[model samples]
Target: MISKRKLYYLLSPSMRYSIRKIYYFPSDFWDLISGKRDKTIPPKGLIFIGPGDFKRIGEHYLNIFKEQCNLLPNHRVLDVGCGIGRIAIPLTNYLNKEGSYEGFDIVKNGIDWCQKNITQKNPNFKFTHIDLKNDLYNLKTEQTANNFVFPYQDSSFDLVVLTSVFTHMMPDDVVNYIKEINRVLKPNGKCLVTFFILNEESKNYMKSNSDFNFQYNFGDYSLMDKDVKEANIAFEEKFIFNCIKENNLTIEKTLYGFWSGRPKNESFDYQDTLILTK
Candidate 1:
């Protein structure tokens, strides 16, 4: 049995978007009529990313940013792949007027919704849509991710965040993004990111978890679906470390998430996390 996500990748982006709307229409309508959905949260149909409760996940990361990343009220932050303002929504409450946020994503609708909903209220938060082509999430754009330059000055951000971003990117694209992240980060700045790391132990766990579709293995990385390489991927530990070392970034902390069928309480986050410093 394959995962629903793998099945989703078998279709085009427009078909996937339509299916999502059809699948969530009943629950979204019920939430709206019952008033159970929080006013601040986006409509269920609009939240394409994330696994669980959006606000809860956002708040959970906020705590980690404060305690682990040492994010300050005046820190300038950058959020790559800021889908539908899920992460940005929580930060609006935490970041004062002194702090600012800038986010960008490949999906135009997500960025459009975010701009209309989140940016109008909080002028400090901004979102942009980049036309990058990805097999899993995007195909309409002809722009390639490997050479795309980030629209920011050098040493611009205090904290850079990329949650579940690298897992969907190819190896070359990931390296370029890492270099771009290093370039945009101020000296002594930190970046928090999540990945599905393939190691000896994780390989053993993958045997037990059928939901994870990292079956097509390359030397350093594995793909969930060969047809859609960006649908899901797991990287080798050495490959990840080598990229970090070569990119002028130093590891500050590493926490392996329980994605490999380990006890949920044993992990810090759902995916393997790393905090790197420039």
Candidate 2:
């Protein structure tokens, strides 16, 4: 069998990134064939997918944001990597007129959907399409993640969110984004971000059983599939903590996830949740 590292080197970067989509195509095709398609689902080419994932995961994170961070109806919010307005759709009814939402993503289709479907109906909710380069999704963009600055004024938001964002991001980019999140947040503002944290317990759990085990330690992080490094990245817990502290953000709370074989009652979502305050 060809080793993952050898296979990674054999394929071009684009191929390595795009091949993961092939794995999901069958499942996505079944969803379409079964007539389960909806406006919530992005087009097949633009799929960051899972059928019914938008509604289910959105509500799960929203509840955590509300409970742990004291998310208020009137607070200004920012949703980084706000794919297809999963969180924005629910917040449309939850947020009052005084509250406003700003979300940005590299994928044009998701942003366009949010603009037309969510923003047009609710003017306060806004979406921006950022052409940032990502090997897996937006390989054509000239802008790289490390240098891309978030378009927002200082101390602009009371709450900033990054659901499944950092999990795909490289370490430098993650650190840069954390700094931007810190700069834009108001004093005592909170950020709800999710990641696949590789700690002693989670690592041990992964060794025993888990569909996605990040076995390849690629320098700063671990990868489930070495060929597609960004498909699933798990960072060291200490590195993440250092990034938060270096950015001047304080961790308010942490809820471990069930992804590492933890019981459902003991965990939150599939990724570890960190509630950080600026």
Task: Report every candidate's CA lDDT.
Answer: 0.90, 0.82
lDDT of 1 by residue, 191-240 (tens): 99999998888888778998774889899899988998987889999999
The CA lDDT at 204 in model 1 is: 88
Query: Candidate 1: global Cα-lDDT?
Result: 0.90
Best by lDDT: 1
TM-score of 1: 0.96
Stretch of 10 with least lDDT, candidate 2: 41-50
Model 1 residue-pair collision total: 0
C-alpha root-mean-square deviation, each candidate:
1.4, 4.1
Model 1: how large is the Cα RMSD against the reference?
A: 1.4
Best by TM-score: 1
**Alpha-carbon runs more than 4 Å astray in model 2:** 1-47, 50-52
lDDT of 2 at 275: 92
* Per-model TM values vs. the true structure: 0.96, 0.84
